[model samples]
Target: MELRDLDLNLLLVLAELVREKSVSKAAENLGMSQPGMSNALNRLRALLGDDLLLRTGRGMQPTPYAERLAEPLNEALRLIHGVVNLEMDFDPARSNRSFTIAMTDIGEIDFLANLMRALERVAPDVSISTVRKGESNLKDELETGAVDLAIGWLPDLNAGMFQRRLTASQYVCAFRKGHALDKGSITLEEFARADHLVVLAPHTGHMMIEHDLGRLGVRRNVKLRIPHFAAVGHILSETDMIAALPGRLVNHSIVPFNLAWAPLPIKLDPIPLNVFWSAKYHRDPANQWLRAMMFDTFSEGAPHVSPDQAVPLP
Candidate 1:
């Protein structure tokens, strides 16, 4: 018989029949009817040109060919099963697996230090690596397991992905601690008058803040145009330049940088920061552990929706 004509399920039935050596016993063990098992035995005999098992004085005995095939068939099935299933347990303390996360510079500043500290305590042997966010091939990377997780404002990562909201964030004007704006409420006119430090972080939902400002016709004397949020805290602390930053970032920087922040005069929508993972790895033990760790570390009191409750984008 040609390989294409072979049914994998038939092989399973043949193996069970050969081992049990009784049609009724094999059918009962395999959850099949007696007639079905008998038909399968007939088909197996015709396919292999061997009786395989024959009724003898003791009940059933295998042909010499059947004896040779039995051990090899069981071994092949065992090997195939080993390849298909992953090790179910992921012991963080013992595992040396390295996980990679994709995020922006701001995410690195906000998450990395705390994440590393947590890792040090529980998963000393495990390591972490990070890749820059907004890569054009990021979707492919996540789907193919090149990146284990992604965090931050990833609006474009819809469909075939799962996201858990981390926090509700909004823009706030941040400046040095003793800056005039720190003492009182900020007005749109005063916000426009100050020399601004604008961050041009591409491929993030943060760009919407600039769009809203433009739509409102609020003008700023942009003194510096930077590409990342990592330097914003330092620059704002040393110079008179004030910048609009996510409230979480400003809060994170305030004590260290001696910076102060107030609500922006312009009304803006709250941006939801989230932790995202590929739907492909949603059930993976290691990936599930990482997702739980991130949620515990950064959810900031937000409600968590279960994977079953939270639907993946189409």
Candidate 2:
């Protein structure tokens, strides 16, 4: 079928059908007549040439074709809705839109708290929700306008995407206040000797600590692995297991939690984090306002989205 002949509205019906698993339920969910949902489904089936759903043991199971199309198509529809709605400019004091962000869990501990505080004091009407950075690539998310910004030390992205450096985070080792490793400062040998708990991103191949270690040709004893960076503080509080964390987390978290932090003898490069988005939205008024708010919220160093963020490249 030619582009103009295809009804894009069918995707909404198909997505709802896939989610609700019954034509009647989908119709109810969308507040439409049952026959309307069926008609939309019929049109989708004709265009795609697939029995998009099958009445099986329990309910509708997607055909291979529909199953494959479901996620991307749903995402596309969501993006379209988001972009259309975003045409209205944001007023920091009056607008109540919640900006969705994707970042590492450590960000919740490191950045989220202060950012929320700043927003509460200034942009009280705004809200923020965070989704953990997982297998879903931020490049795709940013390009599709599905996410406003990605915040972290992502080394790989297209060269032309718009980005701004927030801050470079130093590394520190954390332990219970009186834990043996907390005595003074730690040498590389002592740090290497201690059993380590490395917090890794659950689904992605983005292990910053390990990658940094590999560059130095130095290896350490990693005993436990976790999927979330926010968990490290609790782990350090509860166990003797040593973990290297962003110095900001170490600093703000230590005294209250009865934890102590020491300089790691290893020279892991300070992590330079960026607030990045696609160039397509860079000039859009809403995007421009959001980018400025994010920068003002996180601004510490210079304002350049430098191609050379490397004080020393990781």
lDDT of 1: 0.82
lDDT of each: 0.82, 0.75
Write candidate 1's Cα lDDT for 92-145 as tens digits.
Answer: 999999999998777777677778888999899999899985645788899899
Q: For candidate 1, list the clashing residue pairs, or say none.
A: none
TM-score of each: 0.72, 0.62
Best model number under lDDT: 1
The TM-score between candidate 1 and the true structure equals: 0.72
Superposed by TM-score, candidate 2 places the C-alpha of residue 310 at a distance from the truth, in angstroms, of 18
RMSD, candidate 1, Å: 6.7
Candidate 2 weakest ten by summed lDDT: 301-310
Model 2: lDDT to the true structure? 0.75
Stretches > 4 Å off in candidate 2: 1-89, 134-136, 202-206, 299-314
